[model samples]
Target: MPDSNTKDQIIKSMLNTAFYKSAGETSLANIAEGVNIKKASIYNHFNSREHLIEETCRSCKEYIEQISFIPSDIDSVSKKYPAETVLKGIVDRYFKMHEKQPLIQIYTFIQSQKYFTPEVMDIIQAQKTALISQTEKVLLSLIQNEKINLDSNDVHSTAMWFCSAINDMLSNYLLERKKDMLPFPEKNADKMANAKSDDAAIEKINAYIEKFAELLK
Candidate 1:
């Protein structure tokens, strides 16, 4: 039987491979070579390549949830903080979560495979649904606390709009980062420019959050 450590190594290799290539390219031999084990050793933990791929996807989803800022005690937080404070706190944590390199890798891998893989698509949909639902719950909590004066009827719509706007901003920021990674002769110059760009992007996002919070008041 494969030990837990061995199983974990396999999963890590799978994630790394899938992030750089596609899930379809993550063959058993590649995973085995990554972990420095025989190709057949993988079978002790996973039934087949497909089973390993599924498990890797499951692990990625769980890892994302672990690092995400899904509040467990929304009521208490809503009661403690003002609407602006609450929204800004969430946005700050959201930015921190995206800063994680492993999270970015897993997210990119899942996004690339989502179209061809039904399970990957489901994971993407679930993440979207969860974000919107959580935002709505927070809005409802703030409404109940009399922190914000938004119409109760518009709570869900407001949550959807807020989440969509945040997502778009994040996507654009990531695209700029991707562009920075392209091969170029002036690597140092590009790095400096990208650093400045990153700072400006973050400032823009912060300003958006502040404006959004002000609008809620």
Candidate 2:
């Protein structure tokens, strides 16, 4: 087996290209070249390009988990504040996480492509299960404590919808901004006003949170 350090190096290199460089399929051969080994060497570590993509995704998830701690205020809101407060807090935290971690955004885009293969769908489902389960735990606590109105029927769906919507927003926002075309003159002022990394995340999350809140009314 290849050493752990060597595997990590390969993964690190892939992430740098995929996220920082915004590489498409063309960059794969170049990345493979950097491995300085036969193409078969990579196959020994990962089954295919998709598998490599998934590993890169897992790396991004781990990166988010490491740095995406929720605020104490938000945690407390889940216990003590209204449902709206809790929802907004959750949305805010998610947006901030996306803003800070381009790798997470990259992985999310990869995950969305799983429709092309059953294997990818399976992997994506597992990842979603883990994320939703964690989210459910928090929701459960809030519901049990009567801080939020969540119960059986739509709670899980709402949780998933929020997750999907947030990630989709991040993916699109990044893709659009990174495209080569310049903004129209009329849109330039608006774009510049909201040009900060955090702005798009905030805008998306807040808008979605409002939509989620409306569902209750």
Candidate 3:
């Protein structure tokens, strides 16, 4: 059996290649070359390329969950920190998640493949639902603590709106990154020059989150 370190290397190799290559284009040979391991060695860790890809998708999901700001006990967190502080921290965590290039690459890759891959589609849907649910939980906690003035009746809808808005921001952020990755002709120099800097995009997201918190106050 391959050791844990070897297994991790394989997964890392998959993540590194995911952004620039399609699922079918990511062959075992490419993966093995990335890890400087023989192709046969991969079989010990994963039965096949499909298995490896599935595992990689699973790994990405787990990583996202790990980085996401989903407090296990929302009530406790609301009591410990002011509502604005909690909301700002959540936004900061999201920025950090986007800052991780590998995570962004994996997310982009998963999104691209979701249409053709059932597993990827499931991951996408699951994450979306989880994000909305977690946001609702946080909002409910804040309402219960009298930290925010949102109507309890509107918590679910508000959470959906919040998640949808954040998702749109993240999509635009990804589009900016995609533009950086793709080749652009000199004719598009003006457009490229007009593209927002990563810092600017992040600041915009922060401003939105602050506005959201203020509205709830």
Candidate 4:
């Protein structure tokens, strides 16, 4: 087995490349070159490029989970934090973590390759399911405690909506969407303004989520 240190070094190389480069474009030779190892040495740690991508993706998921601390189970997180505070914190982490970490860059890279490989699609779908599920769990808690109320009986749908809205807003910020791109320049201008308001987290999310938050109250 490759020593743990060498193995870690290899994975780190994958992550750095994963953000800026597509999975299809990321060659093991390039990774080895970056790591100061022979091209053949990559096979010593991972069986193939696909295997390396999978391993790198695993680390990506772990990095997100560890840094965000959004638990899979609701009870693991303390309820003392109000729903607004907790939800805002998670949303803040989603935006700020992407700023401070490689999650979005790597995620965007892999997503750009969805047509090139099934493995990338699988990772994307699994992560989306996990995110929706986690959001549902938290929304359930919020509903139980009377933090937010929904018109729909389906928590799953509303949970998906809540998460989707936040994601759309965040994506707009990342893509730098602006009034010029839309037919309604005024509305688009307002949206662009909202996306940048409040240091790029709170107000943007509110523009997407406040209606739902109002439902909570």
Candidate 5:
């Protein structure tokens, strides 16, 4: 068995592979090879392929938490824009994070709940809970500010729609990126072709959010 430091290095190396490689390209054998270790060595650290993927994903979640964008304050959002615009901005920030971190790939798992073990599913659920709570807080602020009618079903539906729309659009966008297709052509074609910089995802997501926000009216 590898020492603790070596095991840590192996985990990091595996996660790095998951981050850079296409989602379809990542597997346990691939991770083992990248770390110059055998499959048994990998098993020594993790219980199964699903567990390994979960660990890699856990690393990704941490990386995302460290580097991801935080949505601007609700007060600032209300002061600067309408309630619908504020909600869109919040969802857009989430979309941007998912786009830039395709290797993280947890959002789609949260949306689909397939291809992940129950434990990994739990982790993703926790993340989603945090996201929804944040969104709810923003919506509540809008209601308080009188930017949205608190008792109106329209406002409630709008908030729910905002979350679903962003996830649906961004997940489809990432799947297309994996397939090298022009899912958001005209705006995303160049970025898809290049596929190297993180900024491409950021630009497209922000633009999509801006457009989707306008559509909320």
Candidate 6:
């Protein structure tokens, strides 16, 4: 069995891989150079490149789970805060998570590459599915409480739309980095408080909020 020190080094090596290279192209040599170890030494800790990357992504997911992604209980949050406030907070958290783990952006960008290793694709799907499931749950709670109303008889579709909007914006933010991409966010969203100066972003986000509001009634 690998000692804790060896395991930690392997993880660090994998993170460097995510930041600098995609799974399709990453090799034992690449990791060895990043970890400052000989290529054969990596096999002492992990069996293969796939094993290393899978472990790395799993570690990333575990770390994210502890990052205070959300605190409020969905039903209670909807009851206590306006729908807009709660929804905006969801969007804000999404961005904040990206900010905290900028490597995840690079990781995701690489994962979206034309050729994804099966292990890498599994990691991506697991994260995406988990978020979609959580979003659907909160959305159902909000809808049952009449916090956000819509004519769609399909709760799943409506919930997906809300979640997808945030995901789309995030993808655009990472891939494009366009200043005028999405809304700049509002005053209450402390994470993006500086966005007030960007009128164009604000206008776009407000329009997004207004569209959501219209969907309510």
Highest lDDT among the candidates is held by which one? 3
Q: Of models 2 and 3, which has the larger TM-score?
A: 3
Per-residue lDDT tens digits for candidate 5, residues 111-153, read: 3333545655665556655555566667666667776555544
Candidate whose TM-score is highest? 1
Tens-digit lDDT track for model 4 on 27-127? 88767876899999988888988788677766666655454336555544425666767677677666655543355455565566678656667776766
**TM-scores of all candidate predictions against the true structure:** 0.78, 0.61, 0.76, 0.69, 0.61, 0.70
Q: Candidate 4: where is the Cα deviation over 4 Å?
A: 47-51, 58-83, 174-202
lDDT at position 43, candidate 1: 94
Per-residue accuracy of model 1 over 112-208 as CA lDDT, tens digit each: 7787778888888788778888888889999899888899899889998999998888778866764554343222333523433477887888888
Ranked by TM-score, the better of candidates 2 and 4 is 4
How does each model score on lDDT? 0.76, 0.57, 0.77, 0.64, 0.57, 0.60
lDDT of 3: 0.77
Which runs of model 6 end up more than 4 angstroms from their true locations?
24-30, 57-68, 102-114, 151-153, 176-206
Q: Per-residue lDDT for 91-153 in model 6, tens only? A: 667665664333443345335542644655665566666667676776677777788775436
The Cα error of candidate 1 at residue 78, in Å, is 3.5
Residue pairs in candidate 2 whose N, alpha carbon or C atoms collide under 3 angstroms: none
Q: Report lDDT (Cα) of residue 20, candidate 3.
A: 55
What does candidate 3's lDDT look like per residue over 17-93, in tens digits? 65556566778887888889998999999988888888888887887666556656668889888887887777666
Ten-residue region with minimum lDDT total, candidate 3? 184-193
What lDDT tens digits, residue by residue, belong to model 2 across residues 129-163?
66575566566656666665656576788778767
Question: What shift in Å separates residue 63 of candidate 5 from its native position after superposition?
Answer: 6.2
Q: Which residue pairs overlap in candidate 1's backbone?
A: none
For model 4, state the Cα shift of residue 169 in Å. Answer: 3.0
Instruction: Give the worst 10-residue stretch by lDDT in candidate 2.
Output: 180-189
Residue 177 CA error for candidate 5 (Å)?
Answer: 2.4
Q: State candidate 6's TM-score.
A: 0.70
Runs in model 1 deviating more than 4 A are: 22-27, 64-76, 176-197
TM-score, model 5 to reference: 0.61
